[model samples]
Target: MDIVNYTLKEYFDQKKSPCLSFNVFALDKEHEEDEQKWHRSDYFQVLLLQEGEVSQGIEHRNFDLLKHQISVVFPHQINALQMGDNAKGIVIQFDEVLFCSDLLKNELISYNNDLMHKLNHVALDEETFAKINHYGVQIFELFQSLSPIKKEQIRFYIKIMLLEIIEAAHQNYQGFRAPDELDYFARFKTLIEANFKSKRTVSYYKDQLQITSKKLNEICKNKTGQTALNIIHERILTEIKRLLIFSGKNHKEIAYELGFDSPSALNKFVYAKLKETPSELKQELSKIYKY
Candidate 1:
């Protein structure tokens, strides 16, 4: 089936804060059919599997999220998740505004380190898991309360929960560069994500960020080990793969939708990136995603 795009309103009450927490089984019951379908969402999601295993695919990268492991799915990431009968965990969903607050932006940068590589799994030791699970349990309980949930209380717990995950990730990965550099890289990524389909040039982003191309390239390289143009191309390539797998649009149609001059131009771009034509890449991706 085609991937469905889920909006926050569908799962959250607009009157309350756009943040939610639920146990895996409860979430499955709430989103019964969707839980098993390939889908993407407009809000961020963090799945903490405290016990049992949850099989899922993110952007066509398949893996089993086991106990003591956490997987984060950024906004707009294609995901297909399945929970076995024994699965137990907390599923947290919150909109981007709540997550990118000034106090938490820097703390959250580490989570994006592997965005291009699609490495969203963070392995946590027992001690760290216990601490994070505590926060998760608190958030889950707050949402379950009959009384109105104090937005501040839930947000605080969510922040602490994310901080714990960030700490665990830092322990397992290298530290990032200066805050200013990281900020620039994050801004660049945001711009690219917003305009990748219409604007694919590094120069466009550099101009938008009011930075020199050289400086922008330096920032991208420092944060992702890739040049600014390379990052843009990767984003474009990602969308291409998603369209090829989920949109079911032919090459000619996909080209027009993505702003390519023609189908052959799209073919050439795909070949340049993957050393294969779009059809060949589609076949390969279909096999990988079991489309």
Candidate 2:
């Protein structure tokens, strides 16, 4: 199935608010008609499922949500959600500005980076669920208000809600690193996201960050327990899968697009990483995802 993309404006017809690029609302039976399509957007999504069941597919994985469960969808992930007839929940969607803002407190900078990479679906104890639901309800109400509340105030509440849930699923985040180290790690991740196809070497990233390769490796290891090159390979592998399954491009076309010297080079890289050639991996993903 082709993935549909949405901007914040398409979520509703209301005029865009100048101060905020975030939204909080309920998911109820009324949304059933629009729930079948697979979609992607350049914003983060948090689903608080209070009742009924939801089957959510993100990228190549499927997650089932039950009562008292929360699920997260990161920016630009191709995903779909199918809710039960009586499904009810609250959804909070926000762009990167509200999430990875430079205005965030220095302490939250590391936490934000940690959250950026981990996609977690957590089931909470009754008390914790009630507390989180209260926060979501409050945010939804405030989002509908015409009062003069500043956007930062709304973001602060959202942070509280996210921190509570992150704690509930603490195992997914490998704990935080020192602020200084996380700054470098975060910058390295951003650089990789932008240039992983063209620059696959750790030294390239190290030079761009104006740091020694040894220091870059130390920071990546401290944060993720992986060497810098392994991290780069992981990102490249993920993109390769995305293109193979969804881009409808042949191996040679993908090779050229990803800056490989030849199609054979791309095939060799895939076999080295996954022990399968590009065509074999694509067929496997196609069977698993029924795409």
Candidate 3:
């Protein structure tokens, strides 16, 4: 099985110009299916589906996006898209370097830090959709032109578009009150991603976040309906499943890579959590995805 790894340079017409890093294009039947397969990218993407329905899989979750809906895919998330024959949409891919500015980075972090899982595909009202579409077109047009200050103009428009989407997302949940400690939860997730391979203890996260284990568990339960330890386990399981489906590494190799002391340790963990051994789970996935 072949995995599509879309690096930043490969995605932007094989150009390494950071200033001219973004690309906007339409999704039509002529689009290559290989580009739509399970792939990971090094940049952020915002895709607005305008004409028809499509299905997308992000990690372990799958979603259906309809007309006037937009989906945001963050860096390193495994994703695959299936577009209908009549599907028409605009996709904007921007290099992560664009968000290196402190102001822009903070703004995006604040808005995305607490977004619920179900809010990835945001459905906009007709008027709101039109407004967003207008900016998207302007940005794409500026991207195509060689006018002086075109990069600056594109950056300005992208910021405006992001602000509009953030506002819309906030409005989607009426009177949504963000928790004061949501940042802790966000940081906890970040830490999990960074340390889940070697640090599986909730107390480790608590120590790193400078919060008590009880408080951490409370926050995790409130935000994700899982205890802190459960969240860690789930993250680990998600990565394990991804590797199982996407990589040719055998169980023992995966076990060592994932920090399991031995194959039996990995098998025990898998069987205890999923009621299936690693080999059994891989077989099931192969039958489904033909990997």
Candidate 4:
């Protein structure tokens, strides 16, 4: 299956935020059939099966998700859903900002983290099922309230539920492991994600991370098989592709949003990095999901 990545913003815009800022979808087999090809989401999402069978193929690995079992799909993975005849579930999609604390957000965004290890292909036992059911009921009640006046309250409840789910996952999967130790190059990666939009130069990131440019490049190349600058530019380029394809921003607007000094500079970056014009990239991505 071909996999295209989508970020949190893209996910919400594509799917209506039903039930307030959070959306709970009780998908049936017909809807699942209408969902075409394997795609990956950028948002932090959780799927809770209330009835029937829930299964998925993520990056070639298959999952047999029983009732009450939850699956967490992290960003940048190809996922295919196969729901059984009686399949039903509550899928909650929300921005990580809903639970954004300095600590929790950091942990979530830390690329080399084990959050998914615990969440991926997780099964809820009978005891766990009771707890998930309780939260599920609470979510339905909040959704029915339909009061924009309580947006903050809704966000709080959603965050609490997700954290509880994450903690529960951790408990079940005692063998969960942290992502492999980030090397010096990956250290530079962390800094890049932390400060990509404002500080563009290698020197800025290197200085902030207290690593020399040469060492940073060497470590990055070793860890990811790409140069530090290439890695940074690729991330920026990926975001650019997303904005162009998913949004209707004009060239100048996109240039500024991406931290480019001038439209010409943005043009140059697109040409050099992608070997295509900005318009071409946009058209390409549009074609990618024409179905």
Question: lDDT: which is higher, 1 or 3?
Answer: 3
TM-scores for candidates 1 onward, in order = 0.57, 0.56, 0.59, 0.58
Summarize candidate 4's per-residue lDDT along 42-156 as a digit string, tens digits.
4556777878887687654787888878887654445778888787777766643333343454565532345555676777787776777667666666766556544545556
For residues 1-291, write the lDDT of model 1, one tens digit per residue: 576778666654554544332212234445546768877776678888888888888764788888888888876667888887777888888765455544554445545544433336777789888888888877777767524444457777887787777767766744444345446776788677668889988889888889899999887654444678877887777678768876779999999988899999999999998899999988866543441
Better of 1 and 4 by lDDT: 1
The true-versus-predicted C-alpha distance at residue 223 of model 4, in Å, is: 14
Candidate that would win on TM-score:
3
Query: Model 3, range 1-291, lDDT digits (tens) per residue?
Result: 234677656644555443345677777766548557887776668888878888888766888888998887765566788897778878888755453344544455556545644245688998898898888888777767645477667767877887787778767755555545547976897788668889999889999988899999988755544689987887777667767866789888899889999989999999989899998987765543341
- Order of quality (TM-score): 3, 4, 1, 2
Minimum summed lDDT over a 10-residue window in model 1 is located at: 18-27
> What is the Cα-based lDDT of residue 161 in candidate 1?
83
Error of 2 at 24 (Å): 2.0
**lDDT (10s digit) by residue, model 2, range 224-290:** 4568998898777767876886678999999998889999999999999989999998886664233
Number of the predicted model whose lDDT against the real structure is largest: 2
Better by lDDT, candidate 4 or 2: 2
